[model samples]
Target: MKKKIISLFIILTCLFSSFPFILAAQNLKLVSNYALEDPRNLFYLDNNVYVADGTNGLKIVNVGDPNNPQDQGSYSVSGVCFDVFVAGDYAYLANGITGLQILDVSNPLLIDEMGSVVDSNYAWGVYVVDDYAYMADSDDGLEIIDVSDRENPVEVAESSSGGYAEDVFVLDGYAYLAEKSQGMRIVNVTTPTSPTSLGVFNDGSDIYGVFVEGDYAYLAAHGSGLIVVDISDKNSPSKVTNIAFDGMAREIFVENKIAYVAARSEGLILVNCTDLDTDLTVMAKLDDNSETGSGDAGVYVADNYAYVVDQEKNSLQVIDLTASGGGNIWLWILIPAILAVVVLIVRKSTAKKEPSRKEKLSDEEVEEESNEDGEESAVVGIEESESEKEEIELKSIPEEAEDSQEKSEESEQSE
Candidate 1:
């Protein structure tokens, strides 16, 4: 019985400790949404979100209060804004035909362009590092710019990829570009002046977005879904695996080993990418656009919230990524754990106690019976001793009588 209680306690501890995270996977809820016009991509920083609102240019929303997001500022550019990246007090935008445009967003409400440069090709996506900005210039491939002087930004060099460049993610001196028909192109950007193509992985999928973390590059492969590539060997990157879904995978954002995808018709999908070799499981999904028929086009995750851009709806949806039931789930786990502890304690207390009252009474009864038998034996011995004394006395009296008789006969003879 004690062993069973201990085993139950061990089981409950393990189960309760992991219960919250398991439930958290399916607890993504749509909290609030803010209106926008053709919002394309977004970047989260501090407590604000900078969005590339198509023809509306750059729009900044303060998400400090996720339940009630307010528009903080807006910037209207001459060209369509497809992507925006925020660094320090300035905003870098990939303004289609207008090319690379830098804005002084120190004052979100009154954002003003500090510099502007038009590339020979269209700027589809932009990534900023240090004093440089890497642009994915459609057919123009990769365009490197020097932004050391925000007032006079200049294109340092350009590398023409074989296919259309849709998105770019730079890490460890390599730029991983997602080319529409060419899969992914790995470029050695150690020297920004002249970046040469190191290798390419072409799976014939329409790759739209790329995000590199650690040693792998995650690609948003349109109809094919999310594709993982092993880039440990920069020159020869290989495909690790691909997770397929129904809708088009437009964009991807990864944080803390989880990939948040902007799946067009499928809404927002979260994939667990902690273990690439064995577990590429879809942990949760949110498809609340059934009525609108529009799908999610862009996603950015930070502080347990997902900010998604709904294409047709033209709105930014704020999703609460925290597990449901609030703080009550802890109570559920605590109840079971507390019960297991009670069982263990009760079993231990029982083991240290004496025998039952009935058993103790029976022992007392047997001892009383043995004491009565000893008293009876002592009484019988006393009675026998008295009877023997009386018999001896009677024998002595008879002997005296015989002696007296003999003495009287002797006297008579002498007379």
Candidate 2:
């Protein structure tokens, strides 16, 4: 019964999954592209985009023109970096081996690592609040530090929360941690020395990345897709919805009403995040095309242009939003048009003999099955007849042996 149900489910899924690969069509305009590295994170401040180029350290690009972003300078660090988040003039980098490295990007050409927490056990992400820096270290957990003096930072507290924390986002006096596998953890950091875990929302999916705005938590869940949760009610958190980008979401950043998503190799995706009820509508997509450009890592919007870090190509791809109306989708028209064509095709196909190909068996096949069943029955009957004959022969042989034994005993007594 279980096998039958599973088979039926698989068949139904296959039959219903014949729909066309529906993708929102958008008119894209290429702005510029520059050489970089496996740039995983991008921090946009005004026209400057500070990208964390994994092993290549950090890159500072002037994207004022959008179309022609020039790499002003780059700061080399000791370890590979995962992301770069800028609070003020200082950029907090989540360096993998070297822990968290704080740099002063005020002077682009002369960037300096103000201070760092060398004792951290593999920092995966970082966030800054006022004079404190929150490092999401895997083994060290959430390594809290005092960054009051940029030149010298100090570690204060660490919260492992029984999970591996990756990213940290500060809101008000609370910190929303992107705890990989364990989900999102909301911690109270009012007292930087003693940060407390207020609430936790396990997304069930592998929570790799996360972004926050106001009272909402947007998580880049690996297999389960992009998860959006309502963080207004801290204790009793409720999930709003999730937009499955149909790919692995590596990074997510939101500015105003637009959301920039770097979906690994799938490329950069722009969507409207204001409306969570809908599948964060896709605005535009950037991929490896001869006419267009491609990128991943951290995505940010500044001065109407989108800055995407192409991790593999080690390039900075600039996209023009003005040409795409800030990515306003018209799928309403396109979906209907595609549906109309499908309907017309169905009607034409139905006009013909659309017998589901299940009744094409010939009479010879039925006869063959019947013959096979007869052969099995004959084999079973022959085996049963052999067993009855053996039983009868055993009964006769036993009685004859007993009589012969008695006769032998009587003859010996007479002699």
Candidate 3:
């Protein structure tokens, strides 16, 4: 009985402990899906979504109705579209190998190339601020372009850190570069004509994407997972902490204190970064099986839904964030109910095995049975005593017979 009670306690504890994981699993709900061809990157603007479709050029999807996203149109480019950034009425494209391509996207169905600057280095990423576009030119470092003249974009400033710049993000007056093997390099772009390196934080990890919010820079460091660095002092950036994931951290999108991460094969990983002073924790996770494709390459969160780009399936997955009731509440109610049922079943089984009160002997009957047992024991004791007395008499008779024989022998000898 004691062992059974211990087992029940252990089972209940485990069930309760699993509630958090169950809640996390059900948090993300797939609302809808839109298919594209080899979608590599995504960016959300107003009610439109721009996708960098390899070979297919830029594909636009109007998501005004999130539940039913409609394909607006597409424009073909000469090179493979790698990344995109939309500002005002124009869309900037990082055309791999072909260099930077600009397009006027005022009309979703009629996007036209405004201008482009051809460079020897492959343009992997781009970030636009004011009249300038900071391009992550692979091996060539940062190339700043002036887009004020939309018809004729020109390279106003260019600087090289001697590292492979994979992605770039401009904030305040600085350009944050995710340099492949060099970790993060901060460049002072207040003076775009002569961009100079302010500082660098090297962890020797391959950084693929970077996003800065407040004083911390969240880096999607490929195999090393998500690395958080304090960049309040640009000249001396320090590591805050790192949150490791099972798959490669490809890209990250922050909204409402939540870090929406595109974890390649692992899918979308939601992390809570409300407080960076402490270790970052995974709030929830959505895998490929969750109505998304196997290869999660990019993520963009706007309004109440998260738009995920899957390179493997070449599709865009929209996940609902406003849906409710899929939390630990149900688990809380279920655990106790299950425990109660188990307890009742165990009690019922115990009750059936226990003897009924009516079946038990009355006090008088018990006394009568005890008296009979005592009488039987007394009788057995008397029989044992009688057997011993008989044996003693038989022994005495043998001794007397031996004594008579000895007396007769002595008389014969004397005669």
Candidate 4:
């Protein structure tokens, strides 16, 4: 009994001493990181971070400062990209058109486009698990790529077999695909050279993005909404629960109990993915400066600031998640401010949803001529006098009109 007591005392002392180290690791705060241009997606590779800057190419920033980060410059890439993922020393770009590209980002200061494999079409998202790359190739479907050889990425398999595969997540030798129509699919990549479909969970709507953590997968379903799935059984993945959103969801990021989502025009929406039976609580949402379509883009949070990519604004909007107010006055003003912002956003979108022909037309448009009879009819709907009514034909004429006329005649001839 004496010996057992001594052993227990020693073990307890060691455990108690180690508590500080665990607390230090968990006490991480948002380091120095800021936002930049149409930043579409992000992937943290070691100390260096890479971003897909929509039409502006790929931006690599040195996040040596968790707060004030340094810009590592960008590599010129064609097409409007959506997402990026980094593994090993290479950064994989979902180039939208050129498919999945492998860049030599081994040196954070200097990045070179080593090479790339263009998917049958544009690939939206990419995930490298083991040595294989699973790409959510738009239209062409889910493309299986082998990135074992950085210089040469070969396509092993693909299946347009699912809806629009928008995003992909790979782990434990399996790839979880966010298939727009078919929901999510589990493809086993144990055999890196050749991956085979193991199971699929149809979220019953267009799933735009997915993230797998532990035994479950969180998805951002565009129409039907967000879904959680149990992936313990690879052969039969089951839907654990689903939380519907009032707006279109474009992407999702799961960090512990919190699920961050980019809900298009609705801006950056935060959801609590911890409880399946309860409605997702919107922790916070950063409003985009420009009101864009519901398909605008996505958002990412690092440090304590929310970094959002507003495609319509063509810029990255940064929001601080800090309680700097130090008082409850912020909470009181927040609701009304957010409501006002929402109302203004809705009004602006409504104004843009249907612009008058004059507003849509260009400056070069011809000043219409009055056709007395048609004008009389057109205005008659407004109960106007026949003489006051007028009709007009709007058409532009240029010095190269003859050439345009010839092209129109040729098209008519072909018809």
lDDT, candidate 1, 195-266, per-residue tens: 989888878899998999998999998888899999998889999988998888889999877788898878
Q: Rank the candidates by lDDT, best first.
A: 1, 3, 2, 4
Q: Give the lowest summed-lDDT range of ten residues in model 1.
A: 325-334
What tens-digit string does per-residue lDDT give for candidate 2 at 52-128? 88888888888877767787888888899887878878898888978778888888898877888786477878888
For model 3, how big is the CA root-mean-square deviation? Answer: 15.7
Runs with alpha carbons beyond 4 Å of true place in candidate 3: 1-26, 289-294, 325-415
Between candidates 2 and 3, the TM-score winner:
3
- lDDT per model, in order? 0.85, 0.74, 0.85, 0.69
Q: State the lDDT at 366 in candidate 4.
A: 28
Specify the poorest-scoring 10-residue window by lDDT in model 4: 325-334
lDDT measured at residue 25 in model 1 versus the true structure, 0 to 100: 48
Encode model 3's per-residue lDDT on 326-405: one tens digit a residue: 44312322444767877785675456455665458798887888899899999999999999999999999999999999
Better of 1 and 2 by TM-score: 1
* Global fold similarity of model 2 (TM-score): 0.68
Clashes of each: 0, 2, 0, 11
**Model 4 misplaced regions, further than 4 Å:** 1-38, 46-48, 63-69, 289-296, 325-415
Identify the superior model by TM-score, candidate 1 or candidate 4: 1
